[model samples]
Target chain A: MAVAADGRAAVAQTAVAAESRAVSSNEIIAEFVDVHRHYKMGDNVVRALNGVSMKVSKGDYLTIMGRSGSGKSTMLNLLGCLDRPTRGEYRVGGRDVSKLDDDALSNVRGHEIGFIFQSFNLIPQLTVLENLEVPLFYQGRVGAESREKAEYLADRVGLGQRLAHKPLELSGGQQQRVAIARALMNDPLFLLADEATGNLDSNTEAEILDLFDDLRPDGVTIVMVTHNPTVAQRADRTLWLKDGEVEKLVTNADRADAAPTEESL
Target chain B: MIRDTWRIVRLGLKSLMLHKLRSALTTAGILFGVASVIAMLAVGEGAKQDALERFQDMGVTNLIARSKKPAETATSNSQSLWSALSYGLLYAEADLIQASLPTSVVARVREAKRPMIRGEHFHTSIIVGTEPSFLELTNMQVREGRWLGDIDDRRLANVCVLGATLTRLLFPLENPMDQTVLIGDDDRYRVVGVLSEQGRTAGAGSTPYDECMFIPLHTHQRRFGDVNTTRSGGSFSRERVELAEVKVKMPSSEDVAAGAQVIRDLLAQRIEETGDVLVTVPLELLKQEEESKRMFNIVLAVIASISLLVGGIGIMNVMLATVTERTREIGIRRALGAKKKHVVQQFLVEAGVLSALGGVVGVTLGVGLPFLITTWFAQKTIILPQHVMLAFSISAAVGVVFGLYPAWRAANMDPVEALRHE
Candidate 1:
């Protein structure tokens, strides 16, 4: 199955049919095949993820939805190169991410993915513009260029007027905007948001969700984790995670026409 | 890395500024430790230097022979008495040594009492009768007129030299040069010169050189009988007047030991008698002073080092707290491609800056403390040597050694976990 006309290249010896596939190509951006993740609590070991496998294609927006402790966050961490799977191969853009050292993993994270946390993990001491400059500093840009890029990003995020304000001084919605701007500074290939709007009210969450919706037209790939169906409904596709494995995936079409409510599902 | 260091330094200083009271208290520890080191070492070094200066003033290589007696019968009280009775150097003994040894100058003193007067002022003084060479041998200087001549000693002229202070006291307004001052009952001696005043010896109580009067030895023997007494086979007999104080001068002070040895050998051959003489060497005292100076420096260094240790410990404690406080910051830098060495260097710079600042403070306090102490207590001013600076530099090095571990700990923190921390 050639996923031609797509930006990614995928090579698999065996392929399984995924239901309601809307992607025109079989291009693979990430592959977590037969991955297992475990944790130890005192004497007994508990499995956080059990034999879970998934793939994402180029320019694909994904949503991994689950309740607390369903391994959604753990999967996100693995996808972001923050943690390693206990078993099986994990690949990001066809590179074996599982084999990288701590330094290399950090480099991979810095270069390959941009992370947005729920609490807007902007360094509180820095201003909105400085927060955007942080990743640029890590990327080894000089002061003037980094500043110019940060200012441009701040303007793009609609935070030009509030660049001098600290994260603590900003509203929750504004703070998240700063985080998103910071994430985009290095022009990372993948954007991973873990409950990015969890701390915000519905109005702020809706605003941030609209911002995520706005990013799609630019062809930047995104993956977000959310428990709320309303929030997940904004994504092009949603993967329902149960007990650390992918239970089902739903397309926006299935969600729009006669979507299953909580009781019906 | 340089930019990172600058950023860290700016951050550190800002943090310090945020906690003003805490920073002050920590800096105070460094200040006191440095100040105490400078002050203590300065005092000790000053005392050692004072001793050496005094020793050098006394002449490093001169040999002095004070009268001494046989050890067996000499109790502490009786030693002086026995030594006085021994009264070692006879005039002939000095002449014999002078002829036998290749020494520079031999000064012979024959003691006699003479009552001298100028107008109505009469005072009994120890009239030291000696040769013309005595002036050089004793290291005495003439303040006015001239020293007694060879002709005066040979002809036994009735003339005397007054010490500077005595001359001042006797002749208040009028000049004493070429004036007659009576010696004994009928003889009137001309005061040809005044000797320069030498300060009082700590060993010789209240006996300053200014109180003495000098006359020809042959003239002294003609007037007063003799002061030398000797014993042979338990029988007391009058001996030709002995040399009261025999001062032997060499070409250099370093030759004093060899000169003493030669003098002893020459005396042994001429005397033909045992247990009759004693030799006391001031050069031995000089050696003892040198040894004491070494011991003094060691003690000073030990005391100074204690304060330096305290300073180093203070730096370590500050660095440890800094490491703990900046754990997350360390994680961020490490994640941003900082090597372990880079992280270590950031913290080491902080500590190095601290100790280097402390060193500057130490040097300032070390320099100022001496003058301050002198003025406050009205004591002698202290002199600090170049080696004190060397010790302070070592203290800064100690700061670096002690501070390294905490910096390493901060540098080695796990980035992922640190980022996860609230």
Candidate 2:
């Protein structure tokens, strides 16, 4: 009872199977496909990112490793919806992101994705508590809910006693922790960390990583970009990028711990 | 939205508070501009009232009819400086008008003089003759004794009414009412009445009511013997009479025009030449003065408005600088989901509030200055009408016109770019 199948039909069957894998897991919270970000500087065309594609899943702590000019920050910008891809189909939670307008992208950043910068981009004039409430202010979700959420985050970030203090009054680690608490205030779908531990000491970096570890099991997806191998090793998966495109993708087990005091790659 | 605006306003206020000196300097321009407009307007109004009151002191609604010199007549003789040739209103003419009209009052006036009379115990005195009705004509009131009457005129009596200044000169220490004073040869005149003090008319020196004597008109005609006229011709051809004044009375201000028209018509019918009578009506002059005062007030208001406009420009300048200084703040507000309209409104309200406060101060100054000027100086008071809402309203308008540019700049900031700004 052998029925010979046509070559075209067999090829089509494999194509469907590959297409299934494209959206295989509802776990794929965000996807970047052949994204290019080109910027014009005077007469020269600077390719900030050259056709980079990667996927991040729910509860996945992924690290993006690259040198200074390797477009790691640009990748984080694309993920955080702070910037749009020059060309490519970028999707977040099964929604096509190329079509999203600037305001919509901001909304997504404000609601769906939270960002933490190494510089601790907290408004220096505002108190630590007020800094945590900033993203909520932009979300137009003011009142008791936002206040309670800010209070809870202040406690979680170990800045409960320093809530009334301004960013300038806090140390590097404290300010970065305040920024992290601010980023998590809206219960965002993913946390996009851009060199979050770059300015922190080893002990403070380990503490921040431990905070992230506490957040990951709560179903908060994390995508961290860093040049430090020690920071990258804390992630569940590592994507080593060179000149924008992914050179290799490895698991946390494959990324051996580098010297704690070693210089950032 | 209100909460956001409140925050922004608080921030703006904080920044302004930070640079207290600069803000005060900026506000100083507005203060000076506002205060100047108010003070200038008040002074202008006071000056106008001073001029008006001077006119009022002369007379409110009285008519003055004076005689003009005849066109054909000329005074070639140098001895006729005190007396002038007249071809118009005569003594008989005044009598004629009085007898015919059913008016409120009438008075006959004539001029006469006597040789200088000196008593053994007194100094030299100058005497002039006029009728008893002259007391009423000059709006005079006797301070001490009785005025000359009909019996005095009928008997050709030499009873006299002395002015307050003249009484002080003739009698010195004695009561002059019953005393006899010598005039010319073999003639003695009895003093009758002393008039109340008559003040000076607007810029005119030596009011006639101050030092003149009043006698019967008949006595004057006889005493002078037709020598009052400065004749330059043969006996039958010489023009007669010097100066004679006529006063026309009306029932009310509304009837002034009617009274004037009647007098004009009557004079036109009686006189052969039109220029014989130079008629002056106080009511008409008063109206013309009022119209000119209105024009003066408008000019003053326009000048004052320039200061207000300058104040408005000051507000605009401050607001524009504020927009530039708070560009980052504006950017932050825009990135925080504030619409362009919201941003513009916030700035506009801030500017409006600033100017409105300035306006309030200006209005107080405008109203307060006049009272202060009057209290400090012996001057006529200025009156501001209910329609002076322009003081505050114009300042507010200035705020709007000047504030628009800065507000528009603030509202038009791009959120994406603004959020990226440091």
Candidate 3:
């Protein structure tokens, strides 16, 4: 299955090589050129993504929306550098990461991208302060400066007073806030959130969405993958995927006019 | 880098702390292994030292020639008559040995079981008749007064040197030196000196010297005849041995083997058919004992290491389970920018810590067991510092060796799939 995916990604990579030459490195935080991902299940090849091309500019608040098996997860994995695209060129902070090895990808993931999970994946064993220092710890940069930065990020996420608490000790909203604080601790180039508010109640979800909105104006590029249309409506633009292909790319004005409602379901 | 390692170690410790009972049980395996290694080595060392000391007491440079009645010849019916058997080391043999090995100190000994009396007190002990050279050859020390001198031997004086135990039994409360002790039924001898305690045993085939009294060779020959007769089961057996033993000391340790061979050849030439004389070299016995000790230690080490092997397997089993249980944690670490090396380091350090802990506890137990054995069992146990370190190091290495597979499994987990795991 991985081999098939790699073949598809390789094909997509050459298709975008010429276009990538025209794109300026300084203005773009992330770019996916003709990206493809496929999985082989028994006798069938399940295409997760096909020739998906996009660019994430600085300060962009982008949302990827899709139903189950709509390539949203695969796109998140590729964008987060957790896994390489099978055949596409993925440039993060203007560096081609699609062909990089696991270690180099890990370096990019550590310094260039921050991940926020719906489950708030804060290490239960560590306190809030330690969780915020993990990225720096990986970079071998843990010291007084990292501690001060953690403190500041915790305060920015409204978790300044809960710095010593374990993740399980906090409410869902508070844990998500801690996760957000951790994501910002490394001064990453962009934030990749997977179902960022999916585990929270509506009110807590709204609070987290508001936190994301606040971070956007401050030039913190966020690329969120979620299925909820209501969540997608709040982004500057939403990329809709269906059957491993781009169904639509809905901008802010287009979303305001459409305003997905109960009738649409 | 040091700080990072410290953090990883702390993290490893925290994970191990989660399963306190399991971790401790695993540690116990190594603990017992290390303890057994130390205990066995200690026992071996103590036994070796004891044997060495006993051999040393007999004097490593000294060679002993003793008279033994040939088993085949003892069955002869003529042996029942007094003065019928005339076998064993002769006076001429001693003289020949001394003449041939001029650089060696030769002491001729004649032993007789005689009843000793001091006033009203009476005790039976072996009376050893030896020259002054016997003192140096046998490494015997004088505690008080003086040993039997050349004047005593030349004049046939009735002066004796009492063994430590004999002095205690004969004197009880009075000073033994210058005191008179009666031997057999009528002969009286003056105690000129006392020998320091030489313990109960020496090397192989040597008599326990602490319970015997020493007198001049000439005096012993004049007082007691060369023939000794004993009646057993209504039958009287008689044997005539001019010299019971001949102790020959070489000038240096290196000359001992050659000197012993020369003495053996001379004795063989005289009584080649009887085979009634036995030559014992403490140095030879010491070497044999050392060889056997090495074999014993190797067997002991093998047994102890098997326990350590079991302990290492226990660590591996627990670590593999830990890796499985912490799959999600590993994924999280990888997402946070932990390289595969970091993941490997974490688990390896965890295993290292577990074994090191076991090593430490085992050392404590190992060191303590010898002391307990020495105190309660009354067995000598010497714990060498090097052995303790060796056992501890082996345990730690076992941990690393056993931990590698599980650590590799953890490090090789696909981050995406791992994160998806429940």
Leading candidate by lDDT: 3
lDDT, candidate 2, B1-422, per-residue tens: 77766655664454566557766666555555565566666666777676666556545555556665446533424325554444657776676666655663555555444443436544333344555555555566889888888888889997888777767766677888778777667677788888888764521112355566777767766766544543366432334554355665555567667767767777884345546776777768777877887887788778777777777777788888887767765654443334566667767877776776677776776677767777888655554553246566777777777889989987776543544455
Question: Which of candidates 1 and 3 reaches a greater TM-score?
Answer: 3
Listed per model, the TM-scores of chain A against the true chain A are 0.84, 0.83, 0.85
**Pairs clashing within candidate 2:** none
In order, candidate lDDTs are: 0.69, 0.68, 0.86
Candidate achieving the largest DockQ = 3
Q: Output the lDDT of residue B74, model 1.
A: 33
Q: Which 10 successive residues of model 3 chain A have the least lDDT summed?
A: A10-19
DockQ, per-model, please? Answer: 0.16, 0.08, 0.60
Deviation (Å) of A15 in candidate 3: 35
Candidate 2 wrong stretches, greater than 4 Å: A1-265, B1-9, B56-62, B66-84, B91-244, B249-318, B353-389
Q: Show model 1 residue runs off by greater than 4 Å.
A: A1-36, A39-43, A50-64, A76-97, A106-115, A119-142, A154-194, A199-242, A248-265, B1-4, B68-88, B92-241, B248-287, B335-339, B354-357, B376-388
Give the fraction of native contacts in model 2.
Answer: 0.02
Name the better of 2 and 3 by DockQ: 3
Residue pairs clashing in model 1 are: A3-A26, B61-B253, B89-B243
lDDT of 3 by residue, B1-422 (tens): 78878898898888899899999999999899989999999998998998898788778999989887776643565444655576778888889899999999999999888889998888888898989999899888899989888999999999998989888888999999899999877798998999999884852234477778889998998888888888899978777778888999998889989997898789875446777888889898998999999999899989998999999999999999999988988898899899999899889999999999999999999999999999998888898999999989998999899999999999999999888887
lDDT of 1 at B43: 69
**Residue pair clashes in candidate 3:** A9-A86, A9-A87, A9-A88, A10-A87
